[model samples]
Structures are given as C-alpha cells and as structure tokens.
Target: MKLSTVFYFTILFIFISSASYSQAILQKNISLDVNRQRLENVLEILSNKGDFYFSYNSSIVKKDSLVSFRASNKTVKEILTELFNNTYEFRESGNYIIIRKAPIRMTLVTQKGITEEKIYSVSGFVYDEQSGAAISEASIYEKKMLASALTNEDGFFKIKLKSSKTSTAELTVSKEFYEDTTIKIQPRFDQQLSITMMPVEIPENNTVIKPEDYLAPDSLQVPTDTTEQQLPVSNDSIKVQQTGVGRFLLSGKQKVQSLNLKNFFTTRPFQISLVPGVSTHGQLNSQVINNFSLNIFGGYTAGTNGFEIGGLFNIDQKDVKYFQAAGLFNSVGGEVKGFQVAGINNLVQDNVYGFQAAGINNFVTGKMHGFQAAGIYNHVSDSVKGFQVAGIGNFSKEKASGVQIAGVSNISNREMNGVQIAGVVNYAKKLKGLQIGLINIADTSAGYSIGLINIIIKGYHKLSFSANEVENVNAAFKTGNSKLYSILRAGVNLSDSNKVYSFGYGLGSELSLNKKKTLSINPELSCQYLYLGSWDYLNLLNRFDLNFNIKLGKYISLFGGPSYSVYVTDQDVAFGGYRFPVPPSHYNTTKFSHKVTEIQP
Candidate 1:
C-alpha cells in the first residue's frame, strides 16, 4: 500500500513539472514574437529617419520567467535587456533567458527603453542648360549665411548638417555671364539635387538724326532792285546769285549769317568741287535743305575766275561772279576768280578752279588746285591735282597728287609722287618714291624704301638687321630629295664679329624682357638645336633655355638666365690627374648666366 501511494505522488509531481516547463517555453515564444513585432514596427519608423541595420540573438530571453523583458537606450543593448527582463521568472542553463509571458508593465518598459535615435546628411550637382554639360567654378552659397563653396571641375558639391527632426535648407549658385539659381532640400539620408543655369546678353553705341522739313524751290523771289538775281529752280536747273562785290561761293553745303562771317575771301570756282557736306542734286528743285553738316566756321576758295573777298553763304544757290574784299562782311555764291585777298577770310568757287584764304579758318569743296593757301588751315576735295600749301595745315583727297605741303601737317591719299613734305608730319598711302625723317610710315609696294628711326619690314623671306646685329630673318626652301618646309626666325641677335648661327627645324618659342634700355633676359627654346658661335668658343650645343628679364624700355634690358643642355662631342677629357675622372663623351650640363644687351628699335 505505501509503495503504490509513493508512485502515485511521483507521477503527479512529474506531470505538473513537465506541464510548467512546456507552458514556460510556449509563453516565452509568444513574448519573443511580440517584442519582435514591436521592434520591427519601431525600426520601420526609424528607417524613415535615417539608414541603418539591426541584429540580435533570438535564443536569448529576459529573466527566469518564461516571458521576460529586456530594456535599454541603445538598439543592440535594448534587444538583450528586453530578452532578459521578459524571461526573469524562468532562468535557463543556456546564456539565453527562458521564454515567458511577461507582465504588460514590463513589456511596456522594454519598448520605451528601446527608443530609436537617428542622424541625417545631404549632398548634389549643378549643370549648364544648353550644353547639357557640367559647369565648373560655380559658386554655391548657403542662403542663411555668408559661407560659400565653388563647384569642382565635375560640377559636384556636398554639404553636411545635423538634424534632430526634419528641416529644409536653401542653396544659391552664381557665375559670371550666367543667371543664378536656387534650390531647396529636405533633410533625409543621402539626397540628390541637380540644377541648371542660363546665359545673358550685351548692347551697341551711336546717334541718329532725322530731317524735319524742306524749302520750296521758287520761294526765293528776289526784288527788282537786286543787281544779281537767282532764277527760280526747275527740276533740272538750280539758280545762282551774287549780291556783294568780290563775293564767291566756296565748296561744301553751308547755312550761316553775317555775325559768323567777319573775315572771308573768295576766288574762282574749280572745275570739280568735292563738297564736305552732302549735296543732293534732286533737292535743288525743292529748295529744301534736307542735308545737314556741322563744324564749319569759315573758309576761302580761289581759282581762274575773279576773286571775291569777305563773304558767307547764308542760303543755297547764290552767285558772286566778280569781286574782292578788304573789310568785314558776308554773302553767298557763283563765278568769282582772281587774286582776291581778305584781311581775315574768303570763299571762292567756279567751273574752272577756286582759291579761298582766311585767318584761323576752314575751306571745303572741289579742287582749288592751283595756289590755295590758308592762314591757319585748309581742306581741298574733288578730283583736283594741284599745289595746295597751308600756313598751319592742309588735307586733300581724290588724287590731289601735287606738292600739297603744309606748314604744320599734311595728309593725302592716292599717288603722291612729288616731294610733298610737311614741316611736322606727312601721311600718304600710295607713294612712288621716298619718305625721309618721317616718324611713322605706312606705304604700299610703290615706294622704294622708308627711312626713319624705326622701320617695320613685312614680307616673305625677308632679312632685317640693326647696324651689326641680325634682328630677324625668314628663309624657306624645298629639298626635292626629302620634303618641303620653311624656317622662320624672329628677334635674333647676330653680330658681324661674333656670328650666331641658328638652325631651327621645327617650332620655336622665344620670350624677352628689358631694363634701362637693354635686353635683360632673353630666353629662347626650340624643339631642335640652336647654335651660338662666338669669338671665344665654337659650341656644338643643344639648348633648353629659360630666361627672365626686366625691360626698361624698347632698347635696354637686363637678364638672368639658365639653360639645360645636352653636349654631344666625339672627344673625351680627363680631370684631376690620378683620379682620372673622365666625363662621358656625351653628357648633360646645366648652365646659369647673366647678360645685358641694348636693343635698337
């Protein structure tokens, strides 16, 4: 009876203990599933905040309880603590806690301890619109602050910021000749932002003048008392009238009054009048002066007809057939020829030739070719070739080839073959002969040579030297056996006594500097060999020259120079006697030298 009773108790105890063990395992599994679900949900929320990864041991549980809870601030620590806390009621042999259903309070505590922590960063690129290409050297500025950065060659940029919650940032980029752009970014993991920029335009400079009205052709009806009257203009014929004695019409269209013409004179009209202002033959019928010319104060004209003195042309189509002047006054135009002298001014013109002279004045119109002189200045136009000399200055155009010399200056175009020398300056385009002592000369092939302090000779295969030094030479030839190539040399220094032979086969580059009117540093380098043979040494040398110079002016410079050279020679030499240090037959050496040379320009 005792043995049976003991067996029954033992069986009952075993059943209860086994049931408890199974229950603990089942509860722990369920608690683990709950914690896992909570962690996955929290992770999903945190992932939205930043990018991260997570891991933990599933076999571990919280405390001795089948369902225990572990809690901590860090994700890795929080996972371990939640397991231990949930299994505290069912401690196991393994490092893991036994699975158990923990109190709701403990589970809540674990979840709270495992709160997510996040960090955020931002980055991006900028580009050009039309080219679809990356824009380099663009400046990017943080809108809120003065801090800025330039984009790299690839147009990429990056920036860092700290954020506890979500935030927005603004960026501005700018470049020369390009419109600026702005961008807004939301804080997240790594974000990409790209932008494009456009371009800008430019504008020109001048003045435009418009005509207001026109004068009618028969409007000027002279009174019967008028001694010389101009007929009413028809479409084909324009009238001319002269009111004062010795009064004549010079070239160039003009409109003036008596106050403007105090001292003036007039001579006969030349065959062709090259008026400075525009003269429309069609406008003569309408009597409307649609054309306007400014900057004409006073002048004179003289030719084969009788001379007219002291007169001005106030209106169009006036003729001064025969007259001379010794007083102050004004009048206008036609057929005045002779030796007419005005105390201060004159205006003359006709079909043959006209001469006008005035004090500190101006003359404009057709060829007053024969003996047209001005006290201060004169200008002759039209196709008149004759002698025009001015006391102060003279300017002529349209084949005015005679000795058109001026006291102060002279400027002419076309074939000026004669010795048309100005006291101070002279300029002509096509010259048949010579130009001497001229400061600046620009003549075509017709001129034999130009002699001056400085000369620029431009041509193919030309050689130029200054006194004893060879300045420049360009020589080219075709070697039929091989190929054809040309040699160009510029800024070379060669003397008669110390000859410099420079043979440049390929491309050549040279740089020079001057100081105190002398060449300071003249460094020249060529792809091939450059030779310099002097009275002292015959050097068969290869030169790699680097020169720096300080130039004082066109004629003087000081230079400090260095050259890398490869010396090729068939001979070898020994040094330091017994040591017998023989340099290689072919060796490289670097030389440093300083030189000062005077350059003639």
Candidate 2:
C-alpha cells in the first residue's frame, strides 16, 4: 500500500474505534419503571431496551435480590447506580456492559489485645490475601494522628504511638492497586499483627464474541480498567525533588522510596546512617520520619522531627523540625521550623520559620520568617519578614519587611519596607524605607537615600545653569526624592587673570511652602576643588546655600539666595602661573545668583 493510503486507513480505524466506545450502552438515556423486580429480570429488561448484553459472573451480583426504582429519561449509568447502590462499575466490550464490583474501601480488621504500658508499639507484616505473598511498601497509618509506617522488602513494619483516651485506635493499610484495610487494636500496649490486603479485580470476560476477535483477529486487547492509576505530583513538588542534592546525593533506591511514599509518612524514634542507601532502616530510609538522626557520613530521609546531626550532610524529602546541623550542607524539601546550621551551605526548598546559618550560602525558595546569616550570599525567592546578613550580598525576589545587611550589595525586587545597609550598592523597586550605601537606586521612593549618588527613576530630578560669585559659569544636576537628593556640579571661571576649573558633590533637600508647590526652600552643602593649573597643593572650597525658588513656567524656575563660603587652600599659583586669590578666613560673600533651572522637583 502507498504511504498516504496507509495513513488514511489508520486514521479511519481510530475514528471507528472511538465511535464504538463513545456509543457504549451505559451512556444511553432510557425511561424505566420497575417495582421490586428481581435483579436478574431487571438486567434482562435493561439489556433488551438498550439493545446490548449484560455480562458478569453469576456470583458477582445477587440475581434474586429485589430492587425497586423509577427513572425518567435517565442514563443507564444512573439507573444501574440506583440498582447496585453504586458498588459496581460497568465497562463496554462490543455490545456488552461488563459489570464488576468497585474496589473495596476501608475493610476493618478488629482484634483484642491485652493492655500493659502507656506506650503503644505495633509491628506487622503485610501480605497479599490471594497469593499468600508479602507486599512491600504498603502504608500503615493512623489517619487521625498521621502516625504511619511502611512495609519494607520483607513486608515488615514497626510504629510507635502514645496512649490515647480511647482503648482502641484504628490503623489503615493502603497500597497502590490494593484494597484499603483498617485494623483496630489496643493503643496502650505492644502487639504484633499480620495484615492481608486484597488486590482489585477487573470484570471478567463473559460474552460469546470477545473484543479482541471483534476488532482484530490476530491481536489481543488489554482492558483499560487494568491500567495502573498514577497519582500526580504538583509542579512545585517536582521542582523541589529535582534539586542538586536530591539528584546526586540520593541513591536510586532512596529516590524510589520517596516516590513510593509520596502520599504517606511514617514516624520512627531514631535512625543512623552511613550514607544514603546504607542505613539502620536499610532501603526504607527515605520513607521514614525520625525523632533523632545521626549520620556518620551523610543521610537521606523523609524528614526530621526532633534533632539531626550529620558528619557531612543531610537531605530531607520533606519538612525539618526542631534542629538540624551538618558538617558540610543541609537540604530540605519542605519547611524548616527551628535552627539549621551548616559548615558550607543550607538550602530550604520551602519556607523557613526559624534561624539558618551557613558558612557560604543560604537559600530559601519560599518565605523567610526569621533570620538568615551566611558568609557569602543569601537568597529568598519569596518575601522576607525578618533579618538577613551576609558578607557579600543578599537578595529577595519579593518584598522585604525587615532588614538586609551585606558587604557588597543588597537587592529587593519588590518593595523594601524596613532598611537596606550595604557598602557598595543597594536597590529596591519601590522604597518605603531607608538605604545607606555608596550608590542607592529605586524606581520610586517615599523614603531617604544616603549615598554619594542617589537615583530615583520616578522621583525628583533637576538640572540648573547658574553664575555664582567664585565660578562665573556653573552647571549642576540633582537626583533623588524631593526630601533628599544628591548633586553633581562643575564650574569654570572665564576671567582671563583668574582662570579656575572646579568640580564638586553635594547634598540637598527641598521643602514646599504652598499647596501649589510653586515656591520652595532648598538647603544645600557642597565641597569643591579648584584646579589653579597646579596639582602641587591643596585647594578646597566649601559652601552652604539657602535658595528661594519661584516657579516661572512648567519647566522653568528663578532662584536667588544668600550663600556662605569657607575656603582652605595651600596653592599660591594659578594654572597659568598667575597668583591664586585666597579669601580671608572669616569672610562671608554673597552675590545675585540667577539660572535657567528646573524647580518644584
């Protein structure tokens, strides 16, 4: 056959198959009236009305049992649901509706035991009821308290519980593809129990013509009901499981253990491990939550509830409570509640509720509610509510409500509500607090920035050209919030006899005097160096000015105010070898200062 012809035929086959499945008898709407009819007779009537056959094992349904119901234009599913009390499932095979019992839930197994002490300990082996074989990794838990245990390779498990008010507590055993079994036992003593779990059965074939023969003579068809149902993990959980320590440090067996117990957790008193796979709990290490864990080299487990100390590192599949310390690093997949200290690094994939200290770095992918201290870097992907201190840098992807201190830089991608103190640079998208650094920047700010250069992208900005007494032609640029700003200025004395060049930096603040913001008071302090043609001596000039600003237009202003000058210089010659003019020590100089300036910024 040609390729195109083959492709067309394949598409046609799929369409026909889908059509057959979509027209299955269970979905067809029907009107039925029956008053306490025998179950078998009702099935026959339904089969005839839907033009299909009912198939099942004779013992599966009580044929002689009386069922009474009336359905008006209801789907076969609805009718059958009322008949069987929703305890059966139906599947279509050709024209047959194959009936089977739904998987049983919470089968109770009760046993009487002698009560002895205040501590209750239970140990057991789980087995398959049909084959009389051991079932591994079956979860046995007390649902009310979330105390659980998992069967190991030998179908063995042990769990400890405290005495409760009731004489008996129920423990549920569950595994994939098996019926849930609940067992009731004395909660005040130690006992051993054996549990047998039944596997779910699919409805058997009972038709004259099999589905495989009807579809294709040579191929066998597997029923869709027999496929395993896999529980899905969330995207965030998957990201946490794919961390560097989870991938490289955990053994294949440990990973498998984590996957098997994704829906359950079991508590243990204590555990010891030489490495990830070799532990006191053997291959079931990652499935256990322990009170105390001592790792000779390192260890991987589900969680820590009390205290954990490792010689090298510790990797937890879930939350860590109390205290956890390691020689090299510590990685947790869930929340941290207490203190976590490490020699090198500490990584928490979720929130941190306590303190974290690391030699090199500390990272929290979720919110941080306490403190973090690191030698080099600290990062929190979410908001921070406490303090962060680092030798090099600290970063928060969201808002920071506390304090951030670093040697080099501090960054908050969102708002900074407290303070940021850094040696070099500090940045916040929106600043509602204070920032002290060499260079401070913000998109918009209602707070103060103390630095040599402060830039608020959406706040205050001004450029001015003015003629002052000492420097004839001067230009200055101001940037920051209206409350506080930094200025960079340069000037040149154009006079032939006393030619001088000056560059300076200053700090200023503006205060509005009226509702229209047309008039304002500006107080500025600046220092300048006069280059009088010689680099041989010091020439420093300091000035303080108070300027009264009046709005002239939308983008223009007029300003003239009194100024104070203080000069300290040792230079005797100007740049061209002209005698440099030195002002007296206690002199005050003032002249009319005018400019094409921007005001009310």
Worst 10 residues of 2 by lDDT: 592-601
In candidate 2, residue 24 scores what lDDT? 62
Clashes of each: 101, 3
Candidate 1 lDDT score relative to the true structure = 0.38
Candidate 1: tens digits of C-alpha lDDT, residues 1-601: 9999999999999999876764442133211122223332332222222222222222221112232233333342244344344332333322222322232221101111211324333345666654446877666555332234556789886654434354666666666545766766554444556677754321111111111111222122222222332322323112222323323543212212111111122221221212312222111111222122111232222112233222332222334334444343222343334334454544433321445455644344555545666677766555445666668777766555566656766666555565555566665565544443243233442443222221212211212122111223323221100011122332233444333344443222223233332343334433222234222422233444454655555544344455554433322332221111111223332323212111221
Cα shift from native, residue 85, model 1 (Å): 99
Which candidate should be chosen as best, given lDDT against the real structure? 2
In candidate 1, how many clashes are counted?
101
lDDT (C-alpha, whole model) for all candidates:
0.38, 0.80
Residue 585's lDDT in candidate 2: 21
Angstrom error of the Cα, residue 519, model 2: value is: 0.5
